[model samples]
Target chain A: MRKSTIIVLALFAALFLAGISAGEPERVLDQAIRICLSCIGIG
Target chain B: MMERVRRLVQVVFTFLTNGYWAFPFSRNIYQGPLKAICSPGLNCYSCPASTTYCPIGAIQQLMAGLRMSLEMGQLYLGWYVVGSIGVLGGLFGRMVCGWLCPFGMIQELLHRIPGRKFDAIPGLLRYLKFAVLALMVVALPLFAVDEFGAGDPWFCKYLCPAGTLEAGIPMILLQPDLRHTLGWLYVNKIFFLVLFVVWSVFANRPFCRTTCPLGAFYGLFSRVKMVRLSLDEERCTECRACHQVCPMGVRFNENPVDTNCITCLRCQKACPYGAIHLEAGGVRLGARQSRPAQAQSS
Candidate 1:
């Protein structure tokens, strides 16, 4: 693999790990559970 | 022969992703762990049978949440959605559009319904998708807040013919209450959907070329994606046959890694010199032989 590609991959991995640690999966679930009226342009 | 295979694969994928066959009146949205994960393509989250979340919708929600967190004195990010998009885009680029997107397949099928075909938009107009990604998906949700500190999903609300087709129409048909609440916005969306359907019959992937923000996002990774189309200059005869078959109108000879190229591999099949092939992680997938000269003459 190219050095640049490797560097980009490592950076993405670090970001992904950081996001996993910080994100509250529960909150995402709460949002996902209900249909957002605005999402369908109803509200 | 290759075209048939592509169409077959598309049909199979469409059926598999949207396999939930319940009564049309049922308003149940699947609330499983799969709903938490993003689908590889642009399936609407509100679709009654959708097994997964739409990545674009998820990201907009996350961005809206970011604005709310600003007032709460804490930060909240939808890292899972971002990571999923990054990983998927980096791996396959816009291959998802060609192979997986139900909407893309729908448009292709619509185009096949014998009509006057023409290029609906200029080549340079393809840049509109990027503006949509930046403004509607990112900026509007981040800044356009409501009294409750939540931002509207602008793209889904105002645009997104897919949402109009999959969710709005179905929900209206199912729920009497929703039908009672119909207004100009709903009518406007329906009008747009009709226009898109008409345009697709005449133009090749007008939405994919001009309006799809997801395609624009994935196209960004085409240059460095792990799996990509590579052209062999030595073997290439510059016959321009690939150009004729490309639905996206990408000039593969000039740039095999053109962001617009959907990696559909039609060009690979069309190449008479056996110059184009798909490569994944440095391994060649196949070397298809060129069609015989007599076949071309015939």
Candidate 2:
């Protein structure tokens, strides 16, 4: 793999870990568990 | 053989990612532990059968709540979505589009319906996806807020035919109560859904090439992705065979790492001279296999 690819992957992996540590996954789950009425084009 | 494998993989992933089968009885979306993770493809989280979140939808939600999150001191509200997307991009670039996207598979299947096909996509129009990614998915969600300080998922609301097809249509059909809730926006979304569906029949992956923001995001990592297409320049005779076979209009012999390439490996299969090959981390995949030398001397 190229050095750039490794760097990009590592950087993103760190960000992912940070986001998880910050409880973003739970936040995502909270939003996803509900039926997104707007996504269905409902008012 | 590779095409069959690709199709099988597509089918498997499609079913696996959207496997919440109780929707038929419950008429409700999945509310489970798996909802924490986003699907690698563009499957809508609102789809009753969907087991995971849609990355684009999740990102828009976070972006829409950016101001609110900042005030609440939640700094990494959107980081997971962005990071996951970047990690996917860095690993395989648009390979996810060719091999994993249910919508891309749908478009390909539609294109194969034995109709009058047109492959001549406008060169400049290809960049529209990037614009959609920037404005609809990111900018609008961040900047356009209401009195409650939350913004709408502009791409999901006004665009994203995938959501309309996978979530809107199915949810409304299952739950009759949603029928009265439908209005102009519903019709508007259906129009987009129909437009893309019809366009897919006439062209190859028109949505992926022209307007899919997720595909656009992954395409950004085309040059630096770990798994990529490698072209043997010495073996290539500039016959344009790869160009003719490329569904995304990528001229592989000329620009091996073009952002448009989904790395579907159709070019690799089409190169009778064995000029194109798939590579992972600089090592050629399936190196043990030998390609037919039909056009080697030509």
Candidate 3:
């Protein structure tokens, strides 16, 4: 594989691992539970 | 023939993701676990039938939380959102824009309406999406906070026509209570949506080309994405037929993986010599053509 391709793969892997460790799924669940009025431009 | 197939795919996807059938008007926003996963395209989170969250909205929320994280002395980012976008982009690039985005389908259908068509889009305008990503989605949310450490989702609040068309208008129509709360921002967003609708009739994908931050994010992965367009040089005659047919004005003969390309496969169909095809992880996924030795020798 090309060096640049390898670097991109490595970067993606590292970020994915960091995201998994950060409790990203739970955080997303918490946020998704409510509607953000501001996001709809109401607030 | 291929165009018909593309339209069919778009229609099917649109129906599948639309939540109106479930009568979201009477219920609260879906709080399902599926909402944790990010949809591949730019569907609105507030869309009642939306099975997953919009990645752009998710990212903005994460950015808004940055102020709180700073005060708490701990880093809190929407890792799932980031990871989903990264993984999806790395795998498919902007194919999501072509094949999956509900808004993209709307724009495409709207563009089909008979009107004066525009061909040239200024090169500078293409860079506007990246600027939006940097300033509206990232910068404003991170810096433009209030006394309570809560920040505005600038892009979603001020700019996103998807949120306006898909979530804003529908919600207001469904709930009479929301109609009373409408303000200048709502009017401004409706005006923006109207302008985009008119613009799409004249120009091809004005939003995808110029303003969509999700497209900008996915575009960053175009060069390295797992699913990619490959050109067989031997069969290519450099006729520029593909370029002529490309809705996004991509010069496919020169750069098959141009960031502007949404991978609608229009170029592949336009290639008379059958020089272009899609590949995933080095395995060809579609029709493969070999240049006849006689033709090559001639």
Candidate 4:
């Protein structure tokens, strides 16, 4: 309800849309689909 | 009722996020369509059954490839993960930590094993998670690139107990070939994993309080999060009942918007008066109505 909270929420929502349009989630997916060797303490 | 519902939600989220049923047969992690979405909680992507990616792990991976991503003319390198986290954080803040985090549920369950319990951890240690989010999650992955122009997921490799428990142990147990690769790194990770597991039995959410980078990241939005706790100072009796029930050591009467608060609302349940309320997007969810004192947890 406050101005600052509304601003912060709107800002993040915009960033989310931009990120999606830029195909950034696909970039994240490329790494995530594989078994992260370092995450499992290997490689 | 709130506590019981929280536990059920935690269980459901844990199952839904890690519901890939082919792991036992394939002896490998799920590489499915759901991997693209980053879950708000701290479930390891490398876990054989995990359907969604862990947000911290995804961000670190993106940051680690900053050099390569830029070289490939990728203008938006880490915005997806950052924005996703921001959206979730701005909505509920550390409510993800309290309700959806499988690791948080594990820690809480461990603490309930009926042993000599400590009220809280050292207050100074509470700041360590912030340092971890800055250093291990952000700074190291962005700046500490290798000769080949790629960095490492430093936190996952060196410090994440969730990864060790959910991914490393299971993968090694299933593959068996991975056992040959086990060395000091695995031993070191296991040490911290065991340390936190035992520590959780004696204290409430020690890892969340002192070391979880994801919790720290969400905590940043506590002040602005749509879903939050509001304290009616005039009606509050200063009885310290809220403090007694807070699993994360947040004293709501003193500071309703404390960064460490998970917005679990146990404090609201504990209060004798209707001084605390849960608000979501300016709408009162609950906690204003008076309840019997017997409903409060000891």
Candidate 5:
């Protein structure tokens, strides 16, 4: 169930991020980039 | 069973308000509870997947050494926001953190994980949250800054397990590339999460009991909130069922909604006498039950 919940959360996140990226507010785009970068090995 | 209803209300409300979990919104949207009647718990920052405002973050924003304060007899006057959020929290106690809080739902879910068990934190460690409250929420923000004495969301930055677990983990997981340079912040957050999870196995809700500045903010109001708890001494049989069932360990066999009480309504269900009923916002929800509800010491 925990695994299932994590998977559901992951899907929700991916879908939401895709929607936001599609809409891509110019003001927050740079910030989102920072978030993605932070996700990776980058600082 | 009545427990299912409780779960339903908790899940539905948590989902609607914490859209921040599933959606990305900006902080500029709507001002928090400085506008609406305070819901009973700590929510995340306004910008997260939340459909509503985060009262604690908003209130903290208005505090001295924050952005700027316009004081009216110790009332935060700016945007009339501070008074509004504080009043609401005072009215609700951290019940917002307990019931309506999206983060609270997350923690509750974590605790409910079948294999999970709460580990006890020593009595000495219990004070950690209070130190966090005094230092991160108040002292550091008030006195420490880069020449600006500017507050930098000390709670969100340092103490908020909810933010770290929810917004931080979700975003980081979605953008896996950020995992590369996971720093002390990530480490610290994971540490707290592990500690919180282990602690939940035995320590009740250590985070809610200790480090949540939002919970701290709401607790201030639990005693005096307009929608207060009324105990029928006639109905209470000193069965201690309520105390035994309370996740917060509040001894509410006397009065309900005590300082530690999150108003989870577990006590209301625990009473064998059909004794407990919740009254709030000009409405009542009764969990009519027979027998003393078994307290699951999870």
Candidate 6:
């Protein structure tokens, strides 16, 4: 039980870290979405 | 004669590379009809640097760039793209998966390499693609994020064997500098290509059969749509030859619906009892259909 819990936690942590580390280009997408939404009043 | 002309024109304008010298067939004139083929699948937006736009990639670029001005008036539309996908699917289902998809063409070319052959994904796991289609492709992007998240390139990013083959490898190859700048995206693309190609040796397009978001989209009208596969149960002799030939695991003897079938014409030829037919509305005939010759349709 303890080993499985650790593995799952590690997997999720890795996913989160990977997203963060994907750097600016990946996040630039988020900014673009926000800008587009704002243009239409939702941003 | 007109239909043949349409198809010939479609081929000439849509093809990326050709040995022909007849005035560069893949130009703007091919745009209208070929858009049906191009829009429904995740074909590359940048290739031939297209005269039009790929809604999936365009939507993504919009989302990534934050451009959502969907009002009563606009240039192109999500609903139009959705309708095209549905119309094509209802009319042909996986036929599009087999014959017209740019990505499927690439996978078929790879399958023809030296020694590897084809196989089917097992029935139990085929459900995984639906999950990806529903959750990752639609729900996560269209609903879960922002007031409306941008469209997800679910197939391109996660399940697309073709994207890796076409975009990932070529992009990396062309940019000698980008190869030195190797990152996770490049690695993931390679990983996806290797896994999908390896699976193809055992199962004929496990990705298409199971997890292709585009296949899932077309499957909505697979059986009862304007165009579909016809099963003549009266003629069936319980011969599993159709089953043996089917890469998608549908049974003609059981009189299955056509939506999931790709209309590849293999079963039309495979059924010794003549039980299978590709039909649009009431029309029926099946020889020289191309998808079976290529791995995507069968």
After TM-score superposition, the amount by which residue B130's alpha carbon in candidate 5 deviates from its true location, in angstroms, is 4.8
List, residue by residue over B1-298, the lDDT tens digit for candidate 3: 8678777877777766664466454555677787776778888788766667888888888888877866886556766677778877877789888888889989988889987899678999999999999999999998898998878889989989998888887777767788788999888888888988888999889999999999999999888888888888878888798989888889998987799888888888877777898888777886576665554765
Error of 2 at B247 (Å): 0.8
Once model 4 is optimally superposed onto the true structure by TM-score, how far is the C-alpha of residue B33 displaced, in angstroms? Answer: 1.0
Better of 2 and 3 by lDDT: 2
Q: After superposition, how far is residue B291 of candidate 1 from its true place, in Å?
A: 10
Could you give candidate 1's per-residue lDDT for residues B246-287 as a string of tens digits?
989898998898888889999998887778888886678876
Model 1 Cα RMSD, Å?
3.0
Please report, as a residue range, the 10-residue window in candidate 6 chain B with the lowest summed lDDT.
Answer: B27-36
lDDT of 5 by residue, B178-264 (tens): 466578866776677677776665556777776776666556666555454456665666778776787776778675756667777
Correct interface contacts retained, every candidate: 0.35, 0.84, 0.47, 0.70, 0.03, 0.00
True contacts kept of 1: 0.35
Candidates sorted by lDDT, descending order?
2, 4, 3, 1, 5, 6
| DockQ sort, best first | 2, 4, 3, 1, 5, 6
lDDT for B175 in candidate 5 is 51
TM-scores of the candidates are 0.91, 0.97, 0.91, 0.96, 0.66, 0.65
Best by the lDDT measure:
2
- Candidate of highest DockQ: 2
Which residue runs does candidate 5 get wrong by more than 4 Å? A1-43, B20-40, B46-48, B51-53, B60-81, B115-131, B174-181, B201-203, B254-257, B280-298
Q: Runs in model 2 with CA error above 4 Å?
A: B288-298
For all candidates, state DockQ relative to the true structure. 0.52, 0.85, 0.56, 0.76, 0.03, 0.02
Q: What is the lDDT of residue B161 in candidate 5?
A: 62
Judge candidate 5 at residue B186 and give its lDDT: 66
lDDT of 2 by residue, B1-298 (tens): 9999999999999988899999999889999999988788999999999998999999998999888988888884688888898899999999999999999999999999996989879999999999999998899999999987889899999888999999999999999998998899999999999999999999899999999999999999988999999988868888899999999999898899888899888998888778888889989888633544654555
Fnat of model 2, as a fraction = 0.84
What is candidate 6's CA lDDT for residue B111? Answer: 57
Tell me the alpha-carbon RMSD of every candidate. Answer: 3.0, 1.5, 2.4, 2.9, 11.9, 14.2
